[model samples]
Target: MDAAPMDATALLLADSRFPGGGHAHSGGLEEAAARGLVTDEPSLASFLLGRLRTAGALAAAFAAAATGGGDLGALDAEFDARTPSPAQRAASRAQGGGVARAARRAWPSARLDALLAAQPRPHHPVIVGLLVRDPRDAARVVAYLAVTGPASAAVRLLGLDPLGVNAVLARLAGEVDAVAADAARHARTAPEDLPAPGSPALDLLAEAHDRHHREEVRLFAS
Candidate 1:
């Protein structure tokens, strides 16, 4: 059977209801919210914006790389090396493992099940890209996934109004587009050129969250 082109598949793979385990993650927003860094709508807006310019964009690049027949192992290592904390890596791997199992069931194409089956582990963004039909399609799926998980995590972590976070996504539509465009550009850059600089405060928060022993902690530092 022929595969669908990038544009059509982009919508399918990026859907919030994609049965993936992405719902459990906050893309590190849970920690941010806990620290009062993203308590309300405006703060949420700024946090989302910062995410786009940094790690979110880097995820876009990895998704693009995975989409372009790039090696999954290489992408995994690159993402891992860029991540500053061990807890962040563990969280990502957990998400990636969950999503990879989901992909083996959902798409089952390009021999993805077997491909993921062979890994030490699959990264969420890498698996996310392969689920789509092309790099361009992968870009949308990963970007939307990156933002939504964190936003969802925020709502639960802070007890913020659910409708408000959705509104945040709705409000950040243009910024999302800007991030996507930048993601596309980064997709083609050398692996050495990928963005690795993340917020120092965010990193510190994640590290601190580990020692707190809270039942609601969701700090995935990287």
Candidate 2:
């Protein structure tokens, strides 16, 4: 029997089809691919792997914290500081703002919706943390978001076969599982002790994409 509270429901919320504005963001891969930071399938795999390894790690921790009902304010601050580039920060907020708008209207969780309205929009992951039923599920939510959101965006950018992307994601299913487990474990940390967000290159990419505007536009602006 399924033991998870809102497990099926959470899956629905995180589904790419929810129209929560995730479709609009390419997770900086659009910019990376155009700039040749990512070109072929191997590069695509590597890029996702890197993100899953570091940013994914931070996200896991944050989700865990959220599930655990840790200090959201501190997590919010940590998220802001970790995101160094102004443009990437803007993009993150943009995505967050949109998601907040949509989720508030559709799902209507009092705790989460109230938090969304509290000003200085909570980071997307944090906002997501609020909607989910428990603090322990944050990492799973992040993994679901990380995999689906980017994979959906990648389909639009690369014109790569859809089946291939699904296959790729499936291949990394173990990695995703591990990442989620780590994030959940880290969420157990004292709010003060949560791991800082890593991956300077991603921040740099978002910042660079914001400036190096050209014809081949991908939505990931720093």
lDDT of each: 0.68, 0.70
What is the TM-score (0 to 1) of candidate 2?
Answer: 0.86
lDDT of 2 at 213: 51
Off by over 4 Å in 1: 1-9, 110-114, 186-188, 213-222
TM values, all candidates: 0.82, 0.86
**What RMSD does model 1 have?**
4.2
lDDT of 1 at 52: 69
lDDT of 1 by residue, 1-222 (tens): 213444655675566676655665666676676667788878987887777667677777777777666666667778888878766676667767777766666667755865676673577777777776466557667777767777877777778789988999998777666666666665555666666757566556656666553545434432
lDDT of 1 at 99: 73
Q: Model 2: which ten-residue window has the lowest total lDDT? A: 213-222
Give the Å error, residue 108, model 2: 2.8
TM-score of 1: 0.82
lDDT of candidate 2 over 68-172, digit per residue (tens): 666677777777777677776676677667667777676776677556656446677777766674544657767666666666667777787788888878777
Local error of candidate 1 at residue 105 (angstroms): 1.8
In TM-score terms, which candidate is top? 2
